[model samples]
Target chain A: MQESATTIAIAPDQPAPRLLEKAVVGAGARVGELAEADALIWTGKPRDFPSTLPASVRWAQLPAAGIEDFFDAGVFTAHPAVQFTSAAGAFSHSVAEHALMLLLAGVRYLPEQLRATSWQQREFFPHVGSLRGKTVTIVGAGGIGRALIPMLTPLGAHVIAVNRSGRPVSGDNIPAGVETVPTDQLARVWSHTDHVVVAAPATAQTRHLIGADELSRLKPSSWVINVARGSLIDTDALVDALTGNSIGGAGLDVTDPEPLPDGHPLWTLPNAIITPHDSNPPQLRLAAFADHVGANVARFVAGEPLEAIIDTARGY
Target chain B: MQESATTIAIAPDQPAPRLLEKAVVGAGARVGELAEADALIWTGKPRDFPSTLPASVRWAQLPAAGIEDFFDAGVFTAHPAVQFTSAAGAFSHSVAEHALMLLLAGVRYLPEQLRATSWQQREFFPHVGSLRGKTVTIVGAGGIGRALIPMLTPLGAHVIAVNRSGRPVSGDNIPAGVETVPTDQLARVWSHTDHVVVAAPATAQTRHLIGADELSRLKPSSWVINVARGSLIDTDALVDALTGNSIGGAGLDVTDPEPLPDGHPLWTLPNAIITPHDSNPPQLRLAAFADHVGANVARFVAGEPLEAIIDTARGY
Candidate 1:
């Protein structure tokens, strides 16, 4: 509306999503045409990205966290002058929420209670556990893990955020009491923490991080929740521990042989809660991306550093 | 031990429970016999309470939150000089945690997911909801409601705490953003909030607070969680809402005609989650009570006003 107002264009939708339009405008930026806009908020696939962009467009916001396809599509090379930001951390809140739900469900013994047809008060009493005063070792201090720490701490669960460097995960939202542990020192964590939540990226180094030996060291009441990639945990070992009731339970959104096959033991295991990797479903992504756009747009309008900026050289 | 150190006595158990003794000692008090004690920590029934207390005894801590049985036993009348404290807020954490578990479970569509034997990611995607940017109206900002507010806020929920007076609910643990509404104003909340947690006490005026009318106002995605006494909701209306898919679901730790009759339709409802009021089970009580004892002991030793002190005249 003003000469100095920053203009952001929304692509792929003839009329962009109302939420995204509101976010852009709410953050003190105006939605406008791509040719005249200062930045573009993209929701379409990398393949469909514009072959040419006007020089006025200085920034582009991608809809997905991982922009590997964008890298392969050479979207970065053609627009060398433009700054690009991915929706990396925007989607983590929902996944972090899912992790908390799984941990709470497993720790409090919800799967068993869900199956009960009658009131089993006396019988179920001993099994219902609380996280208060218990240590929850989250393997990986990434977006999801960081988001989860605050959620768990309020429920009285002590958080041990496992990162590669063991650097303390300090943030405005994260309480000061969280412990930081290095991935190399994970073996020491098993004997200490009451539960484990695997949220690490799956790499050759991270694969099978929680095997039988690690599982054996954990207490019988300990629960293991995996919201990251499935390969981070040894699924066979997990099934064995679950079958023997050696560990309390496993709440997994991701699985090793994903889709998990129809007759997998994890399906029937009383303690295992499988949610089919629907933690950050399609419907929720637009809102999260809109939030990312709003914050970045606010930054862009103010001529400040933007979030989740892509490293063109490194191909992230 | 210092000569001026506080002396608290644990009755009934020969060695007095180790945890309670540890709590007393941890809180800078020395656990001693009733004859030499300045305060008595009673874990026994109202009938088993010592008929008489030493003149040195100036305070008494009852194990349960509700001290009505102790009142019925005429314990307060006999020990007119002793200050009394009930284990009220201490045990609310577990129940609050349980309420959260139920809410998160219901909101995220866990009941249906737990029943799935195969991968149904596409089918489950739309049902998976997040608390982010959602309104959660907690009825009755008591200990449990207050405890829950802090937990929900970290997950990006805007909390509206409903109390009888609508006095703003602020505590060390509770963040500053919570909106408080009085009981009479609760009718206006159902239409706006995405979820409702019924934590209000069951009083003559509060009974059936959430009937068919209230349920009808909530959206199809709204979940109703009741951790308080079941009478606060009309079970038939709740059934209709849950059965007709008029509401998202009901996650109830307490049900009317509780111990919720074995063959009740609630037990079999796909959308209904029943935990048989076992949120605060017997097994978890000792630890919670010990925590209460520790806090009270610390307060008593510091010459500070003790928590949850019951007035003999009012009989809480």
Candidate 2:
């Protein structure tokens, strides 16, 4: 690969130090020196567009997993000619592991056991259900789902995948015995599924996909795990499902109205495990952004097709 | 496969009315009518030995997992000529799954998270360690360990096995990656292990095997899980280890003094998850004993070796 002159721009935050150290392999400059560089790397919150831009900036690499933030800022529409890419596969392992941790915690009744310790009722321990020989359904068959399939399949679970498009593709590492179903048939399969994982991207058509209607179709012993965007599930419907015992429990990494207000019902629910949207592993964002910037820089000089190029109409 | 006259014997409490109503193609007589039969099959726990046992009693099947009680009652040793077997493999899946459930529960801080919810500190979520890349040492390379290895390997964990004699043998379904170590090396390997699972049988040499010395060798972040007999771990040492934070936590299905007293200190420890001696799945013992009886019947007719034949000297 040729050593090219590229300016990798990042947000002015704590992660900026690591990003500059990793992405800038040679004598590369920052965003202020944009006029003299061939490409610009973006890693920050969305902001107003720059009026004076150089025509030489042909590609832009995003540090975030989802590019919706940039699309909302209209960065893509203004720079129609510039190719954009994102770091989607970077956080799959961390997120998938987090989801498994939550499922195991819920099913084994860990919360109740902990409380029993304080009351001197340790001898009344109950036998909790195991995840072995259970069915798990993944709603979105993307980077995260693909990574999770391999981990779940080996635990003797029957795995099924649902995708947006009608066509089905076999997961590379997923065992042959696992089944793959279409998104339209999720209602038919929901009753038999013991665990449901939602990893779909947040979009206009995907918002509130698992509302009251879908929740009603779930079995009382089933558990819902959401590692995706909070908008994918209706918070009110989920709370009702949990309270009515329509589903066994829920492990939520994201909640609607992010940074849930004090006295939220979800905080006190016995069947819920909530984290402050920090499920993503520490330093993952910086690592992902560095990879994205390196890939785009390679593509810029090699004249090859860029990875994870965003489509304006899809708004991804 | 020969159509022989068989005398089927059963304990007085045997509930076989449903089985009697099903199809019976073979010519067989009950134990009460043993005078007219050529061979004999037995079920359930027998109360006493007959003074002049019929020569037709070619086999004896007891409905139990551990035959130690029967052996202590002078049933197997006295009638050495009679082929003997007990249920073993039936409960392997349930027990192994229970061990994994406890390990996951402890590592994820499920107990602490639940307590924090009731205190109105939802924003103070803490990050616990993940089991994705941890090393788990399973003591006892018998049926339970064999069954558990396959389930845990796929969850991205490194599994190590320790057996009595340290002999290495490969089975059909055991994944190739598992490592088998001798029991003598447990102390040497304790510091590096993240999780320790005790699945060994109760024997003379195994009693108090995990006492104060062994407990002290464990790393501060390590957790102990005992699904084996109560005598395998020293209760006092375990409490001391947890109180000092010498080890991270413990998930004990069986304690030295089974059915711990009302005000035991171990019961009040925040880091310990104590389940009653009932981690075995519902109806697991019955299913296992039934399978054991069937195998013994087949072996008696074929002149083959019986399964799970306890070694009196070893006391397993």
Candidate 3:
């Protein structure tokens, strides 16, 4: 094991520096100025990361679950010596709940009926669907996927989890009854599933992983739910499918080129339920990140392996 | 016990007489003409029930969970000699799932976001809530309520169920971990609850049960979700509260004067999600009712007691 970190700095801070500092102190680490620290807990946006870190710093912690920001900002390549960890599992429960909300919203046409100027019961009745006796394929069987499995199983959904390497889920928090498969088998699983939930991290290999070809394999009554990242699906293909009524619907929390332009067709699509990527909103994110920092800081101080360590090459 | 019904009839039947006939026959009861039927499955709208029934008809099975329709139409009072059973628990799963959808939609401002013309994540962020660490009081701890408790408990909610008699749930399907309370105690449960789901059958005692007084007792942040009957909540009081932002929001599947006329204030309310009371849409209702009829027919033919037997005076 590596030696314990003697000092750490909270960097480019805006929201919860004091809360994070308290957490660091609670974890038996002394807070020091950025230049003098052996480790840094980064709380600012990835674009705000300093061009260089002092030689004293051995590791840095990121505040967000998706580390694509750092990769896009060239932070990892720029600082080859720094080991980085992300607040991945910290907010999974809340996000997973939101994803379930989106999936159910799509099933019941909550979005369409909510916007109706007149009573639409008869019109919407035929389209109303249920999660019961349905099969849902969850891409990226990590923390969020694990949290969602328990909720889905009780509702009678057969959960097919697609992980990068299809490692067996081994945590006490993880529920049984989920069938895990590697990403390679995702193509084979689509036809049998009633719903598809994208929860995988945004990586080059996963980008546009579910495009026209994959969507074609799904039933016309199937719903595609994206809670991970927008880039995972090809937006154009999604728009075509929704417009053509080829697929049942989509429940998207994230979109490519997000903050999807004002007049975007997706905003008006009846089958598409878009939430502007607010799955894990600000207040919840702050508390969850703080929790992650506190635990990771304790681990760092104890010379223990950290949670959510990122693979720089994968860019998750 | 009533003698076994050798023959049955699927009556008035707008939705699925053929399906019910098949179910009845599948249960070993022959489908005969109405006048010759010893048992009748009333599959049409309650208003359509014949004013007089043949003396041969010993039992009449209702195709709906809400038996208030029969009582309101004077069918039960007119035929006091006929035993009646409701298709209650059969469709509870679908309705319970819809209730969960509404609760989550109310928390996440799904309706508001769905209507937004532009990306509104930041605007909607502060209002987004989660079921986690929430206390949800479920009014009407019957079939739908029981099914919902298991889903809510797994999501970290403390479920307080309110029933007519507040009897401890005893069915095998009734999941444990819910605290059952009488409807009379609803006043005390509001302030502590983050959300309230109304699933009670609409009866004389339940009309306007959640009015200005009950709404006033709740925290302003609390959400009121009605998936049962519109009358359970006073629409006028709800409008006033929603207009004044007195409560957090509402996810309403049923409404007073349902098929709420165009230009109703609710149609434009930002916080209120009105869904035309389509929670248990046609397709699911048919299959569920068929299942109930099949099971009850088998029980009746075997000289066993029926399920969901309705008390004429109580009107549930």
Candidate achieving the largest DockQ: 1
Question: Model 1: residues >4 Å from true position, as ranges?
Answer: A1-4, B1-5
Better of 1 and 3 by TM-score: 1
Q: Tell me the tens digit of each residue's lDDT in model 2 across A1-316.
A: 9644445554335355565556555333344355765666665666744534578777666666677877888888888877777776666766776677677666666555555543332333343655666898888988778878877765567888888774564645667866777776777777778888888889897799899998888877688989899999999999999999888888887889676676889888878887656555455445545655665666655677877777766778
Model 3 over residues B1-316: C-alpha lDDT tens digits? 8755499877775444677878888999998888888888887788888888999988999877777878899889989899999887889888899989988988877877887878887798998888886899999987888888888876777889998788876666556777888888777787687899999989999999999998887777788999999999999999999999999888888889887899999889988888887888888788778878999999989889999999988888
Please provide, for model 2 over B184-236, each residue's C-alpha lDDT reduced to its tens digit, 9 standing for 90 to 100.
77667776677889999999988988889988888786889998988999988
Per-residue error for A229 in candidate 1, Å, reads 1.1
Question: Which runs of model 2 end up more than 4 angstroms from their true locations?
Answer: A1-87, A118-127, A166-169, A283-316, B1-43, B46-63, B69-85, B118-126, B284-316
Order of candidate numbers by lDDT, starting with the best: 1, 3, 2
| Ordering by TM-score | 1, 3, 2
User: Highest lDDT, which number?
Assistant: 1
Residue-level lDDT of model 1, residues B1-316, one tens digit each, is 6487788999987878889999999999898889999999998898888888999999999998888998998889988999999998988899999999999999999999999999999999999999999999999899899989988999999999999998899889889889999888888887779999999899999899999999999999999999999999999999999999999999999999888998999999999999989899876788999999999999999999999999977689
Residue A98, candidate 2: Cα error in Å is 3.0
| Residue A101 local lDDT, model 3 | 92
Docking class of 2: incorrect
